[model samples]
Target chain A: MTKPAYEGKQPSFFTTNAEFIVRSIRHSLRNVETMIMAIVLPVMLMLLFTYVFGGAIDTSGNYVNYVVPGIILLCAGFGSSSTAVDVASDMKNGIIDRFRTLPIHSWCLMTGHVTASLLRNLLATGIVILAALLVGFTPHADVWEWLAALGIISLFILAITWLYAAIGLVAGSPAAASGYGFALLFLPYLSSAFVATDTMPSWLQGVAEHQPITPVIETIRSLLLGGAADEHAWFAIGWCLLILIGAVIWCTWLYNRRAGRR
Target chain B: MGLAIEVKGLYKRYGSHEVLKGMDLSVAEGGVFALLGPNGAGKTTFIHILAGLLRADRGIVRVAGYDVTMEKLRVKMSISLTGQFAAVDDMLTGTENLRMLGRLNGLSAAQAAARATELISQFDLEAAGGKRVGTYSGGMRRRLDLASSLIVPRPIVFLDEPTTGLDTRSRRSLWDSIQALASQGITVILTTQYLEEADQLADRIAVIHEGRIVASGTPAELKARIGEEVIELLNEEGEVSHTLTTDGTITSIQDQLLMLAQQAPPNARVRLRSPSMDDVFLALTESADSNSNKEAKRA
Candidate 1:
């Protein structure tokens, strides 16, 4: 009853993932609001912090240089939330079930989602960087510093996107996923991403110095503006890697457990 | 010549609720097998097990000669599942969705485009294919969803409540597509709550009640199980009981029924009609309900 042509031609694992990646990328491209949110949120934040709050804050050098790095990391956070919403929708909409019934591996689909998010984050970061340059934000990064900053930002996006992907799986709806994701967008405000830590209350300064986003923001700011980045650079990479590894493990474990039970 | 799907000793439960208890089914290739059940009768559960979507607590399910659990990949390769909901991507256009599935299922670039074009015309989605599915009508979405599942020439297809929530006209259109598939020798297993749909489309029908098949045979054979003549009695509150009798000819039966209606309560009505798939379904499930109720009283 089967055709000989379609037989024995199971799509290779990598090919399957590549196809899913293409599908996810297509969906992301069509979601105009999420695309806008990805670029606009950070750009809006850049303009607001550069103009509205630039007068009140004090940085040793140009405020754009101080704020651009922070806004880029903030952009990554906002963009990862879109990953959460996408995952939640796929789960609730029966598309995941269709994927499950197919011969394709579940990890391939998850990887596809993460890959699309990485591209979105990359494009969003590029837009912010270009916008920052337009506003006279100069990056003094040498070769190593440039490589290190780009590596750190990519890792940061990968780490946060994986974490939100897990959150999306557990979320009941896309709205709930986005609601939980809203917390990620707000994490920057509590860190040195916006105002100087010293200007904050002494207690808040302690939190601002110790939180995860602070180190990454400080490291990028140092790299972009030509300063010593020894401790901050390692700490930022460590945090991003730590989150990425931990999240990948957790999401894989959750997927296996759910697949087993479901 | 061989069975497209074969199942035995299927059992599933959600805590205390047993959905499919030691149930079994076999479906030959190249025909529509309609599973009819009232809500919670485990029709969906059975299809899920066959499609390798839900794990059965105990069963040996073989689809296209592949064990549903042990050789799930093989089973999946030979089958396509269109779930109760339209599972196609809302963000993609109808053509894009079909092309995406074709590529995901391992067709080459040109093959995918050709297949997508073929399905677009076959499903009559030429105009709707360009529009985002988020803006599609329910009928258009369902047609596209069905088309997406047929990216390859799978020997078997599982359609779970495929016509659910659609208007009559849309449902008829979907029915025609199912008929078209069967005509191409594609085996179809469809779970439906509509008896008329079963009667109209199924070569064979199974009535499921309380997680087990209460009756199975050709649609006419199933109706014949409840006898040819059905006497429907409606009381004042509009509660109806359909009973089959082997009493004399149709006219004689109607004569006796009219006399019985005389002693009945006010506004009572009695009608004599041929047994339909609905009658067979109701008869089997009603009997199952009463038998369980009796056991409950005894316990």
Candidate 2:
């Protein structure tokens, strides 16, 4: 038998980070069944809202098209929470401390966690897109435009995942991470991004119309439904970038602080 | 020899409670230094500070020639710490966990895989290397945890109560691994409640009480400080029985009388004498308790 490669040798930072990422991906992949459930729940919600409550609302275009992006956004939001839960679970399990002692880049932890979430969100996105297509929802955007839209949505998911990951890292328990997820899922629905802001009270409408989700939804709707790019697209892209940057900084800071105190 | 870890007047507080109160320690290079303390004596806290995991409220700490505060990363690079709990991920196999840690420590993918295989065999975990750690026994998890620390080849390692809950066989196995690491010139700082562990493994032992080192010496030195033998006497039929040996001399018979009066049964009592690490621990800790009590009353 060949001697093991690590025999009488020391490991460095690059190898450790690669291993961290690979292990994280493998761990997430093990939950393929759970990922399917995560995808199905939102798709079911989208179907119920569009078919059962379709006539109740007048979206002008197909309600499925109007709500598909919302459902996808909801899926991303919901999926990111599990990322938090898993990260929190790892913290509680003492795995985080183990990583702290190793000679790896501290940021590799956040990267591995957020990357796993991105992979899951991508899987969920594919499933949601397929479900939408099966329900007669069509995208009129060019191939490049569609790809750009996917990229934007992915960036948005990455941003949210990091935010939730930070929450998980700081939360006292895994249950708290889940509680945070529950609170986050309701944000998109309360905004005009999902339903028309006019349907709400005038005072409430102003707030809902200006919320970040409103612009994000508006951007996705325009890109997919063959509409002119509104100022909402710029607003949405700006919102994503700001959140991404803020989340990265905040999560990195929290990780360093917490790890230092361990 | 150069010091691997130096702590001076270290203090830690959580809210109104003090965990460590002006503790001082120095561990020499390539030495096995054991910190022996009862539960809640701040062994964990002291180890945390050395590992660069926690900051002291007041004190100076240096590890591997680097100041812990100003050169945190450099200090971190030279040390590895394994806390009371096994820190392996349950979802990853033993080999995978080692490989991940290896990669994080700067190994390439192929090198990490190769290193993982080597660690697996070194830890005697080959049969279970491919299985997820969740399926492994507690001993296996602990071995994997220790294996993870070796990935970076740190010069100093901190083990806080490393054998707290292990079965006797597993504990012995771990002790061997720890000894092997120390023999390779790695400075090991260990904390444990088991006095025997300290007596057997440590080149030098520091007895900590209420977060302060009350006694520091080699096992034999501490034992010699406490004398060769401790004798306990019992009274039979209301007759006070006494025995004396040059082994442990008492200042006066009154001292023995008072101790027998406090411990003896009204009708009968048994007496014995033995050389033990437990006795030395009791004497040192008792002195510490009395001193601290006096300080508290003064305050």
Candidate 3:
């Protein structure tokens, strides 16, 4: 009785959203398999591309060093897609409805999932970086460059996390979300992540050179190699900003539409 | 008691199908009100609109003195909903689920911890509180779902078929929880297709059919409108041979029983029972369905 004690004092928006983010992160902790999956796929790809294809792929720089950034971004993509599946699962199981009915801000639900994705990617990316280092990969940048690379990676994670959030919302089921999400794993292969674009066949060269991930991988590669190419870095930042803006708007609209119908 | 919910001229349409066509309802505070309707009769739609999850095409809906649309924040703070499916996170422990909801509902971390503990103990989920919800039985999951709604105890709680798919014992236990919630002065709007559930838990019953309320009354009132006790005659094989209805007068009852006895097979036993809520609901909805059919033909 007596209003159950949550009356009079309202929870601030920041705390509520943060608390939900913690809940979502806790969900990942409870199911360590999800994080392991996020970590394992990228690391496995790292091992595959490093040892199996390292001799065949002729790059100017060390193959392991060049492949590390691409694998990190690829891991992020996989993680984001699974984030989509998680969101779709929550929607399917009606936890989204429960959140909608409660007093919290509606955006917090999506934000929570995104935050968890970011955390999982951070861990998975860190692990991939460590594995790359163990296999003779090295970074030539100073502290500022390292920080810049981290910032760029974090922004890239956030941008795609938002995109994946919308995908999760629009997807009908967990399987559909994963199908749509895992499909993004192919993106890194199309980018300049592995071999130089000049070496790729004529038909595949244009796609390899032009996709969003190419500039991002190039920017990270330049940052790790030493000073970044202003063109690639600016392009990467622009891509992240554009995708971030577009995904946030699309996610908000899609969520509102879904809420209205259901 | 004060009014907990009020609605007038509510309308909702899904494409060409109008689910709620000019629906109106009012519910008072501090008691259980059953919205009894079959599936797809707009029961879920009504609960959704009331809970502010879905937008109504047009309506003046209010919950806890705030308009559902214009005063969304206030309305949201005033109510909690347990959807038809148990919405507790299966990945988290039961205690974590409650604490998470509590925190989202604006409780401080400490308050959430204490409240989660209180609810875990109250729902008898102490044993399962630390275990992953995926490991829980259906009954435990349902209880945890209900407890999730009660984290901070909003003034009004909407239970959309809380006991659907539950076993008999689980259903009874949920009914007890609903009763306890009402006893604590929380208003409950329970939407159920189960007649027995409504009869046992609801203080007032609104029988909805075809998106419209065909009857609204207390259980006894609805049953009394049927105005007869049924006499059932069964043969030695326990198969019902004949059923008769009559007033409670001894002479009229005797006459009906004698006729039933004569018509029934040898060694038949007779028993009389009062009209139940199911009978009342069936009669009302059946009549409403026919009236709609007639109107359709006329149109």
Candidate with top TM-score is: 3
Instruction: Name the top DockQ candidate.
Output: 3
- Which stretches of candidate 1 lie above 4 Å from their native place? A1-8, A59-61, A198-203, A257-262, B232-244, B247-272
Interface RMSD of 1: 2.7
Taking the tens digit of each residue's C-alpha lDDT, what string does model 1 give over A87-143? 888878877767777767766778989999999999999999999999888888889
Error in Å for residue A255 of model 2: 1.9
What is the lDDT for B183 in model 3? 93
Over the stretch A1-262, how does candidate 2's per-residue lDDT look in tens digits?
1223333333455544556567778878886766777798888988887888875785454778778888888889877878888877877777777666654565677777888889888888889999999997888989877987898799889889988988887886789888876788888887765577888999988888877787888788889887876687889889889989998898888877766553
Stretches off by above 4 angstroms in model 3 are A2-9, A59-61, A260-262, B233-236, B247-270
Task: At residue A201, give the lDDT of candidate 2.
Answer: 92
- Rank ordering of all candidates by lDDT, starting from the highest: 3, 1, 2
For TM-score, candidate 2 versus 3, the one ahead is: 3
Docking level for model 1 = acceptable
Question: How far out, in Å, is residue A15 in model 2?
Answer: 4.9
Task: Please compute DockQ, using alpha carbons, for every candidate against the native two-chain complex.
Answer: 0.46, 0.48, 0.60
> What's the CA RMSD of model 2 in angstroms?
3.7
Q: What's each prediction's TM-score?
A: 0.91, 0.90, 0.94
lDDT tens readout by residue for model 3, A154-232: 9999999999888888898888988887777788888888877888898898988878899999899999887646999
Candidate 1 structure quality by residue, lDDT tens digits, B175-203:
99999889889998899999999999999
